[model samples]
Target: MKYFIKVVLAESYKQHRNYFNNKMIYVSLFLWPLLSFLASYYSYKAFDLEESAISYINSGNILVFLLIGYMAMSFFRSVVQSAWRFSSERQSGTLEYIYLSPASRLAVLMGNALSSVFESSVVMLVFGILMIFYNRESLHANVVGLVVVMPIYVIMALLWGVFINACFLYSRDTDFLFTILEEPMEIFSGVKVPVMIFPGWAKLLSCIFPLTYALEALRQVTLNNSDLGTIKITVLISILIIVVLLAATLITIHIVEKHVRKTGNIILF
Candidate 1:
């Protein structure tokens, strides 16, 4: 137990130092998300949100609404992109060395996910909080609800990253996951749009991403003052997703330990 904790701490420190060493990286993280957010906010300007199909959104609360979605997304996105960076381990042969070391693989993976998610989201999370509080007239969450749901939201993102990292670790050619998960998650996870009005087919597809559930619970708490009891089903589903992700992460890590990647890609004609 002590060693596991030590590994997690060491791995977390290493990830923060290695990737987050540059102050510009933090600025870019803030800038890119802020830019994407501004673009989305403006696009909705033409629409009459008062007459819009979605009940919770309005001109007054739109900024807070969108900020929450993007804030939550930063957590999930950071982890997925960071996990793909596990490829660096494979490329440097450090992955094999780490495997040979006595450290617990799961602990190391969790540490990496933890550091990435926290650093990636902290900037936006703080910004969102200030905005939400500034727009507190539009905000309506219970303190108890925020206390309960916020941890669930963080856990879901962490586990989601861990699951993705484990799958990427299974083989060298899994880079396609980065392609499939990154853009598609932002699109399908109801980050900018409400799932309520989505077509049945789209709704079914959205369920595949855990962010959909996290965002639902999140928006409800912030915009509707939804307490745990009110969002219990969403909370339940988030818990179930977290459990499934943890199990999948462990299973994938085991498989990854025994699997070996072959050298060289296909030769171009």
Candidate 2:
């Protein structure tokens, strides 16, 4: 138990010091999402939201609604970008040495994920909270639901990062994974739009992302003031996603190790 805790902490410290050594990173992290959020919010001004299909959207609550979506998105999106960044480990030749270490590989991955979650979205999260407070009048949130769901939201993002880190372990050329996931997650996960308003095929694609479920439940509780019972299905789906990702991460780590031993190479292809 002590060794595992040490491994997690050591990896977390390495990740933090190696990539997030500068204070300016926090400012940049907040700015990117803020720009995206502004662009998205302004684009809606050209339309009449009251006439929109989604029942909850209106001029009054639109600002806060969008804030919640973007805030939830930051948690999941930052982790994806972090995993993609970690791919450079192969180029640096540190990944092989880390794999050769005596520590548990899973602990190393978890630690990386943990570090990603803590720093990547913090600035954005704080900004979002202040904005939400400003527009508190526009919200209809369930206090209990928000309290319960917040931890799950972070855990889901952490597990997602771990799963993505495992997948990126296969190869150095992981730009394709970055390309496919980042934009698609933003679009299909209903960050700027609601899944309920999406076309049939688009809705089907949205279900493929765990972000879709997380954001949906988040909006349900925050915008609609829905209770735990009302969002039981979404919560169940999130739990299932968490379980599947944890198992897949473990399996992928085993595969990565085997491939390294057999080929004496860390890069899969």
Candidate 3:
């Protein structure tokens, strides 16, 4: 337990030094999301959407809806970034040192994921505060609900990061897969639009992505004024997804380890 905590802190510090060392990252972290919010807000305004239509599609207050969507996307971004960083380590030959070390692979990955999540959360926090101030009149959410839902969302993202990192361990390049998955995930996971508006087939596809449930539960609790009981099923489903993803991550790590040992090829070409 002590060692795990140490690993997490060390990795977190490394992340701060490596990525947050730049003043530009601090600026871009807040600026990019703010730009995204503006783009979506103005684009929706171009449609001159009716109050009823906006309410139906976005659960009212398009700004708040887009704000939450962008915040959620930050979590997913953390997962992808962590996975990509892991792949970079492999490319740089540092992944072999990781494999040779006595430290727990899962612990190290969790540390990496946590650091990414921490950084992403900083971005989310800044945007969240800005949203609250700008849309103070329109925005409404139960503070208790946010307190309850956010940790689960973070855990889900971390599990996803671990799984993706494990999968990347077996691959030389992840660009093709990342390209195929990223945009579709943003769309199908309801980052910008309500999942309820998706066609039946698309809805079914959305179910395969945990972000769908995370967003649904978030919107329910925050925008729709849903009680914990109302979102119990969604929360349970997210937990189940976490469990399944953890199992998959463990299995992948075991397989990768065995394959590396057998083939003596830590970096796949």
Candidate 4:
């Protein structure tokens, strides 16, 4: 266990160091969240709503809403991006090198996930601070809910990574899948508005989205004053998702490992 933790931590730090060292990338990392904020502010402005109402809505609760949406996007982005990292390494002939290591595949993926977690943390912190300053609202963040729900959120995030990694292992062309998940997740997951506001059918469909559990969990803690019942239900669903996804990922990897051993088709030509 100690060895595995060291390996994951080392790998995570290496990835984080490389990524953070890229100045241009860092600039864009900060800018993307800002762009989301600007778009949310102006898009609402385009409706010609009263300036005070718009300010109240956008800078206050609405701004938090937009930030949370982007936060979910950040998680999705991390999962997809981490999956593609494997494909990219394969193309560059490094995938096998990593796989040849003795570490568990899940450990390696967890390390990559840690990299994403770091990036997302930075994004959330920077933007969260900005939002707090702009809105001037006392955060009064829920410590216990944040602690409990975060693990579930991390597990749920892995589903996207595992699915994409499986797709890359088989087809090697998953851009369409990525695009498909992007919008519907943002739309149905209460990124822009409350999911309760959705029509019956839409709400039903959205309930299946992984982000639904995450948003609900976060909303209960942040908006509803740490509603334990809501958090418990969301945590349960998120745990189920993580288990299912992790199982699928392992199965897929085993199949691919077998195929590669038999046919030596490790690289797609």
Question: What C-alpha lDDT does candidate 1 achieve relative to the native structure?
Answer: 0.86
Model 2 alpha-carbon drift over 4 Å, by segment? 267-269
Instruction: Report lDDT (Cα) of residue 159, candidate 4.
Output: 64
The local distance difference test score of each candidate is: 0.86, 0.86, 0.76, 0.67
Candidate 4 lDDT, tens digit per residue, 36-145? 65687567655543443322233345566567667766676666666666566667666676767787665666676667655744665576657756764634357688
Q: Candidate 1: deviation at residue 43, Å? A: 1.3
Q: Evaluated with TM-score, which candidate comes out highest?
A: 2
Q: Report the lDDT of model 2 for residue 157.
A: 86
Q: Return the lDDT, model 2, position 32.
A: 85
Query: What C-alpha root-mean-square deviation, in Å, does candidate 1 show against the real structure?
Result: 2.9
Off by more than 4 A, model 3: 48-60, 267-269
Clashing pairs in 3: none
Predicted candidate 1 versus true structure: per-residue lDDT over 1-269, tens digit per residue: 99999998898898898889988888788788888988999998989899978777888889888999899999999999889876687777667777778899899998899999988778887887887788889876677878888899899999999899888886777899999999989988988888888899989989999999999998898888788899999999999999999998898887777664332211100
Candidate 1 collision pairs: none
For model 2, state the Cα shift of residue 268 in Å: 8.9
lDDT of 2 by residue, 1-269 (tens): 88998998998899999989999998988898899999999999999998988877898888888888888888888888888878878878888789878889888888888888878888888988998898888888888988877777778888998888888887666568888888899999999999998999999999988889988888888888899999989998998898998899999989877877887767442
Q: Name the TM-score of candidate 3.
A: 0.90
| lDDT for residue 104 in candidate 2, whole number 0-100 | 90
C-alpha positional error of residue 186 in candidate 2 after TM-score superposition, expressed in Å: 0.3
